[model samples]
Target: MSDQLVMIIDGMPHTGWKEASIARSIERGPHNFSLQLSEIWNTEKQVNRRAIEQGMSLQAYLNDDLFMSGYINELAPSYDANNHTISIRGSSRLGDLVDCSTTGKAFAGQSLLQISQSLCAPFGITVHVDASAKKAANQIFNKSKRLDLGEPIWEFLEELARVRAVLLTSNANGDLIITRAGTGYADVALALGQNIKTASGNFSGRELFSQYTVSGQQSNEPSVKLESVDTVLPIATVNGSGRYRPFAVAADDDMDVAGCKTRAEWQRNVNQGRSESVVYTVTGWRQTPDGRIWAPNERVIVSDPYQGLLNAERLIVETRLMLNERGRNTELRVMPKNAFDLIPEVESAASEGFIR
Candidate 1:
């Protein structure tokens, strides 16, 4: 048999072995073949690889591949209708995952956390689950019977501990949603589906992990350029006057003379620059006597650089989760906080395209 005979061991497939060392899809000789893994392997527990092989599909098997070969990473590249998720490539989030697992488990890596990277590393990958399908797969796996030949599905399920996925979903209208999905069932689903093919690449965490620094390719970029300045109204004056007036060319030199919008803006720009925005509103702006404007008491409610993106992630994850639980009956509505105002021009539901 050719050493390249692709075989499914447990739930994942391997490209055979040479010199007793398993060959990486990417590093296997000069043939130039590579492995693409699935996004479902991160949070799920494991058992015997052989058991997963009988029923698992090529994609899940790929998940197993990247995992065994040390390549699995966070959930495969995902997107929303607007097309954006979290930019957690180099964030401490992955470190936090490692921290949590190490603290709780007995061994250094009792979870069998496999990793692979020629570049930046990652922690976890969340997925969207199909509730009904998972339930069915679970029932099927639990039964002490066989399919085609006589192998117990539970043996496979036993190898796969129950798991939940961090998934992304969308409404009928195409608004993205987010949340958790079932796992052992995800394993079953993969067994049925073909390999997850990507023109970009396959779903391998090791491959994904190396993406950030692959060939000196900078993963982080300035997609949106935003600038902010801040200033606070002084509570006291040099000469001791609480009732201060705006800077007058002829009168008070009291203003910081920062030649800026507000003291806060000056501090932000000159002090701690590069802060990203989020959902909170910054207020406390005042107009100067010279018609200049300034904001003093305004600060972000959510200062996380990635908070804006994470908000979108949370929404999509929850939405997927709801649909997985409710199926076709699942209905999602993204009512903007100011929805009524956004469409004030439309006076009726009929005018807004409602069937009623």
Candidate 2:
């Protein structure tokens, strides 16, 4: 493989970038990329100010393999004593959903996919329902759904997604993808003193708790209330540890007892999964042997004795593909597969036996 980073903007291929960075994360909202060009070393041959503008579509590839697609949102040009540089920055198509507000229109008896399609269509974004989220997509909201004026589109969608126990992400084609965690496995592995150039582990217990209690509101019926309790509030709890470290939160929206329990379990599992993380910096953007591009939401086997990880399988939560004077490197952040899964059933079902 050539391992060259090529970016296409407005149907034109551009290369020889002095520096480039593309960061993506399943936990984050959108994938973003930055490119820097300078005239100091005649690296500005591909610089086309007219073609690089806000809202211009862009695609990035590695070894001619597509990885990122989005629009350019930033353009900066600077001149120093001996160099003239241009910096370009942008995010995946989902960034529009994150930055813009909803239409304040109410929805009734609509499914998740329907709502997503309606909202995203205005921005030229398409909705892709992954098999993992098919059930969630088909789930219909029977009640009257109202959106507050000026409410951010992504925030509203995230609330709906949380209720369904699924996630909203974007693919290389810049289309919104409804999916679950750990959807696939990487073709290669990362091990200490092997493919990984540097490794670091972060183990913290600050966000974790021994117990999580999720509370939510039900109906306003007097029959639902207890002895003198004016209103009825559904509450569910999940244990995290033996200690008394308890954390409580309110539901994102109105839900049932089962939903509350799922929310609590999600909080506990995500915290426990995030409590420990391993970050690895590899030499190139692709796997050493298989040549597959490093991507988020994929599980990979990790064998690093320093972090007590012995051929353990973990989810790739985030990745940063970087190319600078030092050369191309990929930084991967992995955590427990269950961190992003909402319910235990989902987590258990997605788990596969360790890779050989």
Candidate 3:
């Protein structure tokens, strides 16, 4: 059976798109979509120019499953001698956080969940904090948390996420998800000459470095005594196997020595993983052998001899679903599973039954 793509605008469902694309990423960011419709008409054979408008609430669905909840941001209608088309573009609710600045209010010992709720409540965005992230958030802050004036909410949250070693992602329904990475797994595997229609690899080392140093001030006093030393700034370093290139970064203001080390290691791992990346295009908008819809942030097993990968598990970083004259296709960008720095989700007995 063919999958259906429906967009509900102002409580009305429309499915007459001629070309469309939906892009989503595992990163805590916005999912975007664009649709082109050739002269939307009503049952009375009249053009429905009022069907779509900017700022209208929109919900996108695939096979009755809600995929995106957002607002229409752009509307372009064009008419030629014989062809008339309407192009609509929008992003998931997270787009609001990305575009708008935080209130710059300071949080005094507030948990991440509380702070997130305060920031998202204004935009009607919901928050779902994972158990692990909640635990991390509960840690006592050495100093009061404050947002920079006119700083985008997304950027603030991303900085916090890095310091806490968690991930900021969103659900299909557009709710903000503060969680760890690799918590989910894909049921189907991608194999060469099988499910993947096309595969390409990017093995660039421009971003890789031989060493990474993160320097910052630690909040706590040093446990060990250094002879005749009053204080020392905490600094952490990680070494890589690239050209003698060196990289250095400043740790977050709230980070300690341990956090600095974690950040440095994260930088190394993520860049190394990104240095050797792969993109796979598979026919259809879902995985083969199971027909499950493609999703980001899920780990999947891959076997591609041409890429020198054999049963290697990888993480799905992004997914782009496209429909055009050629047909429907799902393009996936994947990297090594260790590219992420968040803690892995622990499995429960009940989850083992369905988790692959």
Candidate 4:
């Protein structure tokens, strides 16, 4: 603890709170938290239905570091003849994006940056694009539309991010960020015998399709067929070895045979890379040695023999932090760097358990 944990409710800092936890993600989703307070003798510190009705805003800080800022979305109070406590659950500013529905908008030739800026303007968020983002600032959206059925702005933006191999996240100051996946972040090494408390590794080939056949069909054009196979070294010798698993795809529009082949190959490589994953639980909120905060999208070095991993560099795809009266801990979900380059899956088989 850096002696700077502060929880502000409606701009007023309150002390003596218990059992607080905040969760943030790089998936362009909402960050949320749960807080508990004792109401035994503090009449002025009680949170009740009135607070919920008034839409109480919340801001949290850890030693000069902004942890969470949002509004109270849910409130629950529990009282017994012997004990008294009030618990509140809420989300961050991203909640506004998740709840607001958009009425079918068309961006015939607008760049992704322009579209994101326009969409996030209503929420009072500034959108920042990384210099290394795949799509240029002026690149036009050839054809994109929000359906008439209406959907959350966050959901719509998430779809675009997926297709473009980009990530959307918010900074400590509550500004929106659009950047390429796994880029623009520093790598932190997590030594097994040092700061890491517990770790587990899991690898699966159940859904690994060793072969893919793609067929591209265009209006008034001949159908073209292409095949892609998994032969990327190390991975080829392990989970994908001797497995002739086959999958197929039907590409729409004017995709030629070469394009289909490239797409299939890319998909095969990504799936192969994602088959293996590692989960690490560290003691502190930040990585040891450097004291930098652990965040998603950054790279980390793992050296643990119990998991059969040694001096391996991996990408941090997800991170979860838990803070309470006891202590603070961080959990990280990591995968091979290649996993970040694959195209997002739009659909998948109902049953992926069978190897064939």
The whole-model lDDT of each prediction reads 0.20, 0.76, 0.74, 0.66
Q: Work out how many backbone clashes candidate 4 has.
A: 1
lDDT of 1 by residue, 255-321 (tens): 2222212322322232121121112211111121222111111111111222222122111001100
What residue runs in model 2 are displaced by over 4 Å at the alpha carbon?
41-51, 213-244, 249-264, 343-356
Residue pairs in candidate 2 whose N, alpha carbon or C atoms collide under 3 angstroms: none
Output the worst ten-in-a-row residue range by lDDT, candidate 2: 225-234
Q: Write the per-residue lDDT of candidate 2 for residues 180-225, one digit (tens) a residue.
A: 9866889888888888899888877677665567776666321111
Residue 251 in candidate 3 has what lDDT? 46
TM-score attained by model 2:
0.82
| Model 4 lowest lDDT segment of ten | 347-356
TM-score winner between 3 and 4, please give it.
4
Ranking of all candidate structures by their lDDT, best first: 2, 3, 4, 1
Per-model root-mean-square deviation over C-alphas? 28.2, 9.2, 9.5, 5.9
Model 2, residue 94: displacement in angstroms?
Answer: 1.1
Q: Residue-wise lDDT of candidate 4 within 1-356, one digit each (tens)?
A: 45445777887776556677677766546677787776553345543322332268878776566766778888777675445676888777777888888666666566667878888898787788777674554465555544334667787777666555577776655667777556544445767887678887777776566567766664443333333344353454465456666678776434666666667777776776688788888876766433566777777777888876688777787777666765777788888777667453322221111112
